[model samples]
Target: MNAVPFRRIGFDIARDVLGKPDILLLDVRDPASFERGHIARAENASPINLGRFLTETPKEKPVLIYCYHGNSSQAYAKAFSESGFGEVYSLDGGYEGWATANARAAAAAPRLSETLKAFLIAQGFPPDDVNAVGKNQMTPLMQAAHLGPAALVAELLAAGARVDAMNSDGSQPLWLACVGDDPEIVALVIKAGADLEHKNVNGSTALMYAASASKAKALMALLEAGADLTYENDGFSALDMAGSRECLDLLRAAQRRLKAAS
Candidate 1:
């Protein structure tokens, strides 16, 4: 018998699949079990009718299959894979496992909300002392920059967080944003007046970070923002750190343009 490729689904995976618009959840259990309690939007297609159901259902969408204790689902998942379904999953512990995990998450819901609220408040408020550091010696602005959430970065900046504040390792917010490779977040910090030329402990700048991370869009954004290409750290310029061929070509062309202009 040929092996069929199928993923083993856990509660986390099932929950993620539920949110996708193009997902098909299959409950292979008997009618009574499905009617008692099944995942929202799941379809009941018992083993006997599975062939007919497969003929009607779209194969391109992800299919998540589950039975009483997951054993039956594995057989169904293999069948679907053999029939050329691109994405097939067998729920590891079946519907029973999903129900138990959901209950646990529900019980912790209030604590999760409070923790989220505290995080939001910390980003929105100004630091009591501008130089104050957290556990890792990272100020609020530095931490926000590393996360690459444009809204949080904006909130921190608006709260009077210093754009040039350095972490313990001497990395600035712009450098951290470049490391995250998010052009929008990088642009946000730039618009908020972050220093494009500021160097970290190793003397590397934000442009170097973008190049090293192979972030072509971010590298382009840095170039358009007028980052100095000639600047070098330990004798290695942004051109040297350009990890992708596309970024290397862009850096070389930009360097030529800068030289010509000078």
Candidate 2:
């Protein structure tokens, strides 16, 4: 049998803790220690319950593990690697090192308001921080889609905002763009990799929104982007939601095309 390989990352290099969407932060410390303070969004899964934790976490996602001083974390990291995790890392100095360096920065990094967001973006703020959620769990990109200047939406997308990020209502930025009836914004989001088939809490998709709102250009863009025509929400498909004759015609044509291809 061979030992699994994993990386050991120092506090300095691990500064972008929450930036990666697929990175899972695991704090394998005592419950009391975790309760006192652990990294933001880090899950506490003590060694005693390691098996259960591993079962719940996705093996494909990168896992960063930390313990009291770092020794215990190495064992956990190795365990994750051996269990088929693609990327595993042990924090070099563990929680003590991170807290000493990042506590203040993390605490001070407030969610930006739309006005402040615009100001900072104008001043060249990093786009990766666009994931920062504000009121109603709306990411900066979602806010931009809602408030637009379509250019701002494009800027955020260029900065690597996750196009599929859902708001409190499970509405993604693409859905909001459709709701706003901004064809340009809808196109920008689709170009930036928005999920055309993403459904909200009510199971209504962006295509449905575009059709219902009579957004001809947006509906056309979605169809071109391969939005699923057969997707039904609460028994209503995009074709059923088409409010205008033009929208209905487009959806029907698309449905026929898809049916023929299948």
Q: lDDT score of model 1? A: 0.75
Best by lDDT: 2
Q: How displaced is residue 37 in candidate 1, in Å?
A: 53
TM-scores, each model vs. reference: 0.50, 0.56
Displacement of the residue 108 alpha carbon in candidate 1, Å: 35
Candidate 2 residue-wise lDDT at 142: 78
lDDT tens digits by residue: candidate 2, 179-211: 776778888998888878877777888898889
Ten residues in sequence with the least summed lDDT for candidate 1: 125-134
Q: Candidate 1 regions off by >4 Å?
A: 1-117, 120-132
Query: Per-residue lDDT for 210-252 in model 1, tens only?
Result: 8888988888889989999988888889999999999999999
Model 2 scores a TM of: 0.56
